[model samples]
Target: MFTRPASDEYIRYQNQYISIVPEGNIIELLERQQDDTVNYFSSLNEQQALYRYAAGKWSLKEVLGHIADTEAIMSYRLLRIARGDRTALPGFEQDDYIEPASFDTLSNEELLERYTSIRRSSLSLLRTLPITAPARRGIVNNHEMSVNALAYVIAGHELHHMNIIRERYNA
Candidate 1:
């Protein structure tokens, strides 16, 4: 979905808000992110998973699990929107998504595998997109979004969490 490139002002604003991984190829970013994400999670041991920087923050494992889950959901959004679907998608509450999951018991390797698989599929689909497809507008979570923007947002979102894992989890 090719649209005109994002305005320099908009790009600069987004850059200030999120430290995007420097890779311009979205496919490479998604693939390489799996490795980076896995490394981040694998560095944590059980005790580290339970450690929290603050009382209100999530533990390391919980944050990793959340990233795995969020990738699944977000990748699905990318898939649907890239297919040219215009239907509005539903939003989710992270608390609700995590409530029943026992993050403490899940192995970091397992979580990493799950995340990697999701990214593999997402990257494959993204590679098939015509240049113009990403700019196609779609409704996700009741909000309008361009598929191109969502791809950038997905990368940024992961970058944000990776920062949190480093700064907060120390794992």
Candidate 2:
């Protein structure tokens, strides 16, 4: 089983997200989360899925898109680093991506379908990585990070957004 990442494995800013992940087999947690997230979002209707808790905040659809986008990015980083790639990966602006994504144009069902597909791809890639691959490190956003840390960040980031949807959006 892959172990949880230690503090030294990632930058401090990521700890806020990483800390939310419960101690366990991270791959299993990520796999279980796919269903949990899909079920939770699937429970919402069109109106609820479009809700924005406050002005300047993202609507539910946008948040879902953001989650999908982030997962794809992180998983790609994980793949590269695990494969012994040493190149520095560039950072992306989430707002820039979200605005152009036109997530609102897509139905909630469609958004969920896309998210599920991306997550399954990620799971497939992660499952194929060797046990030692988790320890592989690479530069991302100018900071060094391990494949394991990125995995935790992927899971914890979703948890963060889910908490926001529950507390702020009341969904």
Candidate 3:
């Protein structure tokens, strides 16, 4: 149960890509997010989950699949950086990842299942990381980022997409 420290403006500004969940139970917060995401999808029908804001944008199913893929990628980066690997990690373009029209065939239940499974794997990986690993730094997407920073970025990314799904797609 790693507890996140209180947010300082300087640190927040430095790690602009991350989210700041309250201190004293960051793992719980992550797990809470996992549960909330499950509930969020549970309430939606396939039509709702598959709704798209525009012709070019991703539908809700594609969005969920994208989240799962991104989580896997971020977790892999976290694992490598935490293990002291100094390799420069690559970044992904979400738009490119979500394209190709393959995800349109997936159902809401399948998307949710994928999201849940990927999250479980990520959580397991995070739980086993040594404390010192969080401080290790690495280059990702041509920017310097710490292992801990990547964790927060993972959480924030999901929140960011979910917000869009709610407000824009009405899902």
TM-score of each: 0.83, 0.96, 0.85
Query: Tens-digit lDDT track for model 1 on 1-171?
Result: 432235331234444323455646766776777788877667767776678899877777777778777777877777788788878888778888665888777777776777777777767777888877777767766567667766766677788888877775654
Where model 2 places Cα greater than 4 Å from the true spot, the runs are none
Q: Against the unseen true structure, what C-alpha lDDT does each candidate score?
A: 0.70, 0.90, 0.74
Evaluated against the true structure, the overall lDDT of model 1 is 0.70
Model 3 residue 44 CA deviation (Å) reads: 1.7
Those runs of model 1 whose alpha carbons end farther than 4 Å from true positions after fitting are 1-23
CA-RMSD of model 2 = 1.0
Q: Which run of 10 residues does model 1 get worst, by summed lDDT? A: 2-11
C-alpha root-mean-square deviation, each candidate: 3.4, 1.0, 3.2
Query: Which residues of candidate 3, in runs, are more than 4 Å off?
Result: 1-24
> Model 2, 128: alpha-carbon shift in Å?
1.0
Reference-based lDDT, residue 6, model 3: 30
Residues 51-124 of candidate 3: C-alpha lDDT, one tens digit per residue: 77998787778888888888889888888888888888887777787777467788877788888988988888
**Candidate 2 lDDT tens digits, 55-164:** 98999999999999999999999899999999999988889998889998899999999999999998898899887888889999999999989999999999999898
